[model samples]
Target: MFSATLRSRAASSASLQSRSLATAAAPSSSSSGEPLTHYRITLRRSAIALPMNIKGTLAALGIHRRLQTVFHRHTPDIAGKILTIKELVTVENVPESAVRTKWEQRQERKASRGYEVAGSKLGAEP
Candidate 1:
């Protein structure tokens, strides 16, 4: 058990080191020398209930029901669509890497909790 814990700690440290290196290596700005800003848009609600025109806008932004898409830099077209369906998309300005990592962590936590609940329910069923 001690060896297993040590191995897990080592692996976790290695992963974090690699992530930091990758982030450090990333270019800080675009070709135009402007700071590359990115936004993470998560579709919390389904836009299927909306009309075709609004749905088209959502699709154009690469957002579907319960999906998330990250856009680099703010474009007028994107901003317009976001404004049009402000209620459907939850937008946040964050580094793309950070956004992805945060979503993955959230998913992992949710999955672990779901499995724990399911396991407890099964054990009680008998």
Candidate 2:
């Protein structure tokens, strides 16, 4: 019984990898034609020296390093991949418009510059 269970788990993980790749390559909306949702997956932990499979999965998810986030359209294959590396990352659903580019994310992280004064450096003296 243990062997059977192990075999099944291995087979499922293998198939999941393939399916995740396919989904990440090209995504399709449902039959209803409504826009598909997206998942913003961010790598919270590094896959360094862990295992080749885990590293590959991060690459497949478009996450290269820690705290790097990537958005992917919602799909079963992507979901499977997320599940495989769930411990190393975080996931959230967001509309397409909510997705921000790398530059945008950086800008958002930066502390806002305080209001600038047009006439500064020289104060009125009586």
Candidate 3:
């Protein structure tokens, strides 16, 4: 049992290290060297049974559903809202280019059609 726990911890740490390295390589930024300017906030937990103000805060942040992500500029107001519900979400600093609208996010979630029909066999001359 002890060995199992150690293995899991080691695996998680290794994954964290890899993730950090990946972010370090190609930062999401423009050629002009603009710094990360947005907060990519994803709701990781639901506000069910929580206080009304907490729920209100979530709504103010435009987060209505669990696992829903919202991007907002780095403003004091947004940061305060995030801090209020810090335990319920994950925040990442992202460049402006990384922000996506609802439609774009939905489009990305769709699986691409792997095969495209070029020409019908019957339409082609044998």
Candidate 4:
């Protein structure tokens, strides 16, 4: 049991290291450094003691936890939601091109599998 905890701690540290490397390799700014087109929203604070309307505002924005990030296009509805919970989150405008889906962000954080598979025969027709 002690060994398992150590292994998990090691793995988590490795992942943190790799995530830092990924950010260092490519900066997100555009070549021209022009203004971004979409809002890069991050939940910076929790709504624990806030009113139900405030909590609902966070949910409407797709924020699930403290520090959780979600992006959205610049629209009236989104702007209103952001304004409603302006105290709880931080917002930045990022280029539409820079926005990434949850899956894409996951791929960035994932460590590459060390081994490559040449082919699989399990799905072969009989």
Which candidate number maximizes TM-score? 3
Q: Write the per-residue lDDT of candidate 4 for residues 97-116, one digit (tens) a residue.
A: 77888788789889999999
The candidate scoring highest on lDDT is: 3
Candidate 1: tens digits of C-alpha lDDT, residues 2-113: 9999998997777677664543334442124534456567787887667998889878877655766545456777778788878876775544444444466557557444
Residue 3 displacement (Å), model 4:
54
2 or 3, which is superior by lDDT?
Answer: 3
Kindly report which residue stretches of model 1 are placed more than 4 angstroms away from their true locations once superposed.
Answer: 1-36, 96-126
Can you rank all candidates by TM-score, best first? 3, 4, 2, 1
TM-score per prediction, in order, is 0.46, 0.58, 0.68, 0.63
Candidate 3 lDDT over 1-126, as tens digits, reads 999999989977776777755433334422247688888899999999999999999999999999999999999999999999999998877888889999999999999899888877886778
* Window of ten residues with lowest summed lDDT in model 2: 23-32
The lDDT ranking, best first, is 3, 4, 2, 1
Candidate 1 colliding pairs, count: 0
Please, what are the lDDT tens digits per residue for candidate 2 over residues 1-126? 999999989977776777645434333421245354888888988888788988888989888889898989888999999998988987766667767888999999999799776785567774
> Listing every candidate in turn, what is its Cα RMSD in Å to the true structure after a full C-alpha superposition?
13.2, 15.0, 8.6, 11.6
Write down the RMSD of candidate 1 (Cα, Å).
13.2
**Model 2 C-alpha lDDT versus the unseen true structure:** 0.79
Worst 10 residues of 3 by lDDT: 22-31
For residue 108, model 4's alpha carbon misses the true position, in angstroms, by 1.3
Cα deviation at 8, candidate 1, in Å, is: 30
